[model samples]
Target: MNAPSPFSDMLFEKREEQAILTDLAYANGWMLDVDGCLVKTTKAGGAGGHAIGGAAKLLDWLRRNERKFVICTNASQRTVATYASHLRSIGLDIADHEMMTAATAAGETIARAHPGGRILVVGDEGMLEAIRSAGLEVTPPDASNADAVVVGAADTYSSANLNAACLSIADHGAPLYTSVSSPWFHGGVKRSIAVSSAIAQAIASVTGVQPIVCGKPSRELGESLRLRLSGGNSQIVIVGDAAPAEMRLARGMGAMGVLVLSGATQADELSGLPVDQQPHWVVQDIDELADQLQRVIP
Candidate 1:
């Protein structure tokens, strides 16, 4: 039913190719890996999180082996603690410390760039807490002394709030930062627009100050993850379904890209990608990927 994979000559069947490619991913030594959002959340989409196939097994194995990996995601609706707890409830053995989120990245970035500065955040309660936890002061939208604007996932947006952000950036000369660049996300039954991007764009249009993104595909998050890794020239592998987030992260970090079909991306989409943008390996899901890793690992 499917055309032979372009990698067939060197690796044979899909299963074999998956194993070989995963092996190659770790060939340089240890691997510093990050997963896409859908790897933990349901592909069908919904308000909460669920473990996908082999998610628990793969994460457990990695933890038991003390492998270097993190579940990096663009979902900023909840705090990292909430997501970690949700994953654990779904049988995935993940800890809060093992997760990297866009909200957290945004907070850290803002703190690094301007410590103790006043940040006006247009996001959920979770995002607000994350920024506060990072040691930056959170200011209300109407605050006149705001030093920066950080946008994250919000359920609602009002023109008044947007105007405040614009004023902060344009009139006050404050910088703008966004949690993620994605325009939308899978909402279980359908794709829903990402309010963060909308808010960011609205303010950017008015202020003409493009946002500094602090999520996946941005080197800010990648640099944070790199800090957690054991010092070495170890190769990294970014596994995800979203091409723009995970694949772009791989290319930026000089890491291998692995695309799983159990999420937002479909098989047909692979053929249309440019060679440089294409993932190094395409598999059914994380289960298949874990299987391949098990076969090659000593």
Candidate 2:
């Protein structure tokens, strides 16, 4: 009859973690994770594959609560507009600004840390583009002029690149910034080195300067999303594929979390985990998530 709070035992008990479905009834809207949760991975086609089980329904729900649905994703390679267009072509008409990426988070962090400094960016064009859009100059600077060494997913973080960044950091004392430390999932295949983790390790090894990570599980990402919520933490919901990142975000922000077993995490993986590490809601796929949200959110 009544909506369940995030603290309910039926959902988040000590060893058995179930999806906290009732929490959705009270939320303003939801923050849905894109990629594996919604769009099925394609080889190169624009939009030919079928939508993930709940993706279509989720899109419908978003259409109903246009202001409430925010698409937060870790895909750092593209701008929000590009992502919005992809969603649109797939029949999910979400606004550009509604989509937040790790690139944006990394860029925002760089802006806050150094207002107008020369950046030695070590990521894809998307990462560089986000930095430039944030009103900061994106150019290779002299060692002394280099303010910070920001790294993301770039195919060319070679030894020379690392040495250059290390020199800038060691000589000019530039702070290091990275997009995230998680594994890169491109079309469902995991990459060897996460750019964030690699650059961070390189910075440490060369200049002995630790990097500041900006994406996922980080307080910055959570706070950035929290600011856009309809209400305070109580009315916010975080839907994500990873446990460490999204669930940590939920606990840190005091928001509800929905973990879907579509991407990185598996069903067997949940059998033995502590309560604090568990999600409030666990579903087989995003389609089920859409049904639960529609039934509760109206």
Candidate 3:
């Protein structure tokens, strides 16, 4: 279980609308989640994804106001450049540098701790690219001298890679890193199982060692995101659909957590939770967020 957040008493409510308006107006940077908050894949197994309603316009407004932000995502099935092109095709004004992924976060975090370490990767092109780009050596699944094990939502997960991750962590104690623990992500217009979480869990089940998630609410991911912002975000608002990821991230950092109903989660699900487990605010989508910002900003 998560320790109670220091901001537990600071949770937002509709009656306290002024509090959020104040935060939004003064926030120096923003960290936005991509899978559900901003875009959704068209089908369960589609090539690319589509931007949410008014996502492009919302991003444009942020840029015009000179607000520092990054499109943080847990999905690393595709390269950042490839994902950027898909966003562009959907009319979003996103550049390659504006995006960050779980693979990227894990690579950066692992690199600083173990520079030039040998990493066993159970992922695809994007995950491989991230680790290699970080100056880490990518060893095959069955390598014995691996320094760490990094897992992503791989399209080619099999007995071979699964055996390698389990052995590396359970037997070698190499440590396990995963993208996100969320079980589902938006695919097209529906929710689909997130494979990486399943794979990580299987290894943990055998090893009795849980994997460290490196996306969304993870500080490892947050550090990577803050570095991307022009000046690190002193005040931030984390907007995303999933609570276990984005909401926990906000609580950990004392940032405003905004739950958008445009993704896997919905309004009906916000029944009740500890102050630390809930969002600071809730909106239907970025369109509503834009409306809220319009009311607050000069």
* Top candidate when judged by TM-score against the true structure: 3
Q: Let me know the TM-score candidate 3 reaches against the reference structure.
A: 0.87
Looking at model 1, residue 74 earns an lDDT score of 75
Instruction: Please provide TM-scores, in order, for all candidate models, with all chains considered together.
Output: 0.85, 0.82, 0.87
lDDT of 1 by residue, 201-252 (tens): 8788888999999987898887766666654366666777776667777778
Candidate 3 error regions (>4 Å) = 1-15, 42-47, 230-233
Q: Give the Cα RMSD of candidate 1.
A: 4.8
Q: Ten-residue segment with the worst summed lDDT in candidate 3?
A: 41-50
Q: How many collisions per candidate?
A: 2, 5, 3
Q: Choose the strongest candidate by lDDT.
A: 3
Clashing pairs in 1: 44-188, 45-188
Looking at candidate 2, the ten consecutive residues that score lowest on lDDT are 42-51
Q: Report the CA-based lDDT of candidate 2 relative to the real structure.
A: 0.70
lDDT of 3 at 7: 75
Give the alpha carbon lDDT tens digit for every residue of 141-256 in model 2: 33344788887766566666677788878887888887777655532323234556666676777677777778777877776777677556437887876677677777777888
Question: What is the C-alpha local distance difference test score of candidate 1?
Answer: 0.71
